[model samples]
Each structure stands twice: as structure tokens, then as C-alpha cells.
Target: MAEKIPAGGTDHPGRGDWPVIPDEREADLIGLDLLDHADGPDLVLFLAGNQFMAVPELLEAFRAAHPKVRRIFCETLPPRLELRQILSGGAWFRGRLVTVVPDCWATVSEAGVAALAEAGRTERGQCRAYLRNRVVCLVRAGNPKGVAEVADLARADVVVSQPSPVHEDIAEHILAMYRAAGGEALAARIMEEKREAGTTLLTTVHHRETPERLLAGTADAGPVWATEAAHAAALGLPLEAVEFGEGLDQRGRVRYFLCPVRGGAHPENGRAFMDFVRSPEGRAIYAKYGFLPV
Candidate 1:
């Protein structure tokens, strides 16, 4: 039997500390995807997954400015999956069907925005780029593997945590950076040869998981958005970045595009949120989390 240790290791009770909020629902699924007002949201947003860290700040400010919008449901999944969800009419979650259509959607890929326009779900001209980001090699603090640049990821000793091109939109961009650094051969070596060799770890969500991989010693390094590395550092995680710089980092190419869904439930709410996103306040919030401004 395991002995139970007192709270705080000394049974030191503090004011308003010991409590458990009772659950009234039969099944309360837990996840951060559903933010602010969970049920009956007036405005819904489907955002690119890597931008998950910025959602809270964006929401708080949005609420402060537009107090009437009490419920705002935002889902932060990979942009591709989010697009598919929007196109498919609905998606299943926890054995339940969630058919809530997003009023607004954002993606790092123009193709994703183009797809929606092609489907006639959103008007083509409304989609616009709002933010920019670039790739970097995320490494543990001190960079024990001594990875200096994007090309260094191909070194025999560096185990790279690469995002899967199939799931994450950022993966192909990172591969492009590899191509810039050491040409197509280097890109093939990292994604093909080393991937088959089990040294290139493919992550479903690079921004969220690469830090975990680096800290847990599962990966020596990873190619992730520079903002992701900065966001991880801000969280007090033992992580840092080996910057790919302007040429290799895909500076102009890595633009974040946004649009309001044409036939969404709340077009007014979506337009208001889009204003906030491109506003000075929105840019500041994203910059606070290390995103590059458009």
C-alpha cells in the first residue's frame, strides 16, 4: 500500500484552497478546444492549431471590447483538419456529433482558404493574410547536441522531431526551409532516409509536442515555428531555438490568412473579431506570444 502524503507535504491548509467543483452533467468532456462560453456560442472560430497559445489573450480582449458577445466557441485544430470539418458539415467528438459551424476561420495555408472559396463556403476576396512566422530548430536549453542551423538537423547525432506533412500545415514549410539550407538532397535525407531510420520523429502537432519531446529527451531537436520556441520559453520550459534566419526561415512565405465564413451563424460577430485580429491590440497580443506581424 502507498502512504498518502499531506497536501503541501505538511498538511498546511491555506484559505480557499481545498475544494472540488461538483460536476452536474452525466458526461463532462474535458479539453481546451471549447473556450469562453461552451454551449450556445454566438460566435464560433476555427483557428490554425499552432496559434493555440494566443487564443486566451485574444478572447479576453475581444470580450472586453464587445461585451455583448457572451459566447464565443473557438476550435484550435490543424488548419487542414479544421477545413475538412467545415466542409464535411460536422465532426464527431466523444461519441457526439458537433455540427457548430465557425463564423470565422484562419490558416497559414492559402490553399486552405482557397479550398473554402472553391467550395463557395467563403468569398475569395474576403480572405487576407494577417500574420507571419518562420521556422527554427527547437532544441533543449544549452543545445546539448550543438545544432547550429537547420542543416545541422541532418547530423548523425541529432534526433529531429519533425511535424508530419499529412497532419500539420507547418511541416511542408519546415521541409522547404531544409531545402533552402541544404537543397533537395538534404531535405530528402532528413524526411526520407533519417525518417525511415527512426531518427526523425514525426509529430501530429509540432508546436505543442516538440517542447515535450525536447524536454523529455525523446528528441534532440525539432523544426518548429520560431514563435513556438519563444512561446515555450515564456512558459518557463527548458527550451531554446536555433534560428533559421530570413532566407531559410520562409519569412514572406509563411503568412497567416483569415476569413469569415460566408453562410455562418453570426457573420456580424465574425467580422467584429476579424477587426480585433488586425487591430493594433490584436497584433500586440500575438506579438506578446512571439508571432510576427503582417
Candidate 2:
């Protein structure tokens, strides 16, 4: 196993080894964590992993619009970990302590913005919903596992790569979807009983693990953002997305927010990026990834 990254590592010794991203297959196990120019950027950001597909295009366009801000470092970690990294001051990634301060923080809920504001570390900026997404079941082609709907996820034969509620906000929404489909019993069966039976594989980074596990045939299906499944499918992965109706999928619950970090090194860059995200062109980038723009 690769060295585990410690959580809530706010106070580290100092800056040292920058993240050494593993190869593609190896990284599928750890979720691609780093994005953009990480080595000394004029602006840094902590973004939710689900919307990761839109970052490269968004950043590239933002840079083109404003060439002054050349370097931009963005970390697409889970929202909770991203919050902890900002609150704790740094992260002990692998064995190295990374201490880069963030200029912006984005998450699935406003609670992330509130948390930073409470810490007095949040900057005054456009803190509002910029994107939205809903749940879907990612399954193999031809529907071999027979997972046709959300309720099928609770079947005894199915093994699900469920995201950890403790680490990811999406888990609660997924749990709600399960409850809507099969009541509390279904939620318990998949989240508790199946997990005990070694059927529910908890994933810290479902964006990477869900498709990886499904394609590897280790898991029959997983609940993921529609955007995630679409992004993976676009990459030529042999997978199909099972759409959940509004009654089952938590349609209006998932909203994404971007909060500027107070006292960041580059204030203008953060503001510029946020402005661009709300622009029509920015919305197009997110829309390209199957995300609903706010």
C-alpha cells in the first residue's frame, strides 16, 4: 500500500516535497488529488473532486482571459479534507508536509463557506452556487449486473463502492436516495449490513474508485454524480450511467459553492477566477462535463 495521507494536518513542520502524483492506474486508487501549476502559483484553490473534469478547461480559459495570473494551483480533494487542509494550515501528503495556503475553497454546500468565515479565514467575495449535479448509478455495459434502478443497488448480489459519509458529503445524498427507493431498511442494508458482509466497499475518492472498481469487476455499481460518470465514460471507459428519476435522485440538493480565502497571497487572482466561473463561458465548461450550471 502507498503511504497513507494523514487527515487534519493543519500544522506541519514546513514546506517540503510537493505532491508526487502516482501513475494513472496507481492514482485511480488514491483519486488524482493535484491539478494546475502546483509548484508556485499566483493563486491556489481547493475544489471538490466531482467537478474536477471542468477545472483544466476553466483554468486554461481563465489564464487566457487574464495572462497576468500565470500560475494557478488547485487541489481537487474531497471537500472535507480540503476544509481541514485550510483550517489545519497544511497536509502531510505521503511523508512530505505541504504548506501551501489556498486562495479559494469550493465545496458541495454553503457550510464550507460558513466554516471558513467562522475561522475568519474566508474572504469577502461571490460566495454562491455556481454549479449543480445529481446522483446516478454507474454500471458496466449491457447491464450484466442487472442494476436497472436505484433500488437494485440494495440487492444481495450487488456490491457497491459507496462513498464514506464521514469523508464525503455526497454519501448523505446517496443515503437519502436509497431511503427514497427502499426506505430506512434499504439504507441500513447497503450502508451497514452489506458493509459488514464485505460487499459495500467504502471509497474516499469515489470519482476515481467507482469506475475503477466497476471496470475491474470488483463492484457491480456505485452511486456517483452524473458528471463523474459522464467524465469517465468520455475517457473511453467501458461503463454506462443509469439515470435516476427526480423522485429517487437528489436533484435539487447538490449545489456547489466557491469561497475566496481571506489573507490569501493573491486576492485579485481568486476574485478573477470566481468571476470567470460565473460567466457564460465558464458555465459552458462545466456544462461540457454534464454538470448543471447555476
Top-scoring candidate (lDDT): 1
- Residue lDDT tens for model 2, 1-294: 122445666333443423332233232222223332244568787778776677778888988999998766677777776677677666555454556677888888666677788888874355767888899999888778888887787788999999977557788789889988889998999999999998999985445688889989999999899888888778988898888898888888878888888767887888888888889989988888888987
With a 3 Å backbone cut-off (N, CA, C), the pairs that clash in candidate 1 are: none
Tens digits of lDDT, candidate 1, 1-294: 011234454342331232211122112212224432335677888888788788878888999999999677777766776676678665444323455678999888877778899999998798878899988888999989898877788987889888878657898698788888889999999999998998998875335677888889999998888878888888898888887678888887999989888768889999999899999999999998888888
Error of 2 at 211 (Å): 0.3
Per-model CA lDDT versus the true structure: 0.76, 0.76
Full-model lDDT, candidate 1: 0.76
Report RMSD (Å) for each prediction in the order shown.
10.9, 5.3
| Window of ten residues with lowest summed lDDT in model 2 | 22-31
- Which portions of model 1 show Cα errors greater than 4 Å? 1-39
Clashing pairs in 2: 10-88
Q: Give all TM-scores, in the order shown.
A: 0.84, 0.85
RMSD of 2: 5.3
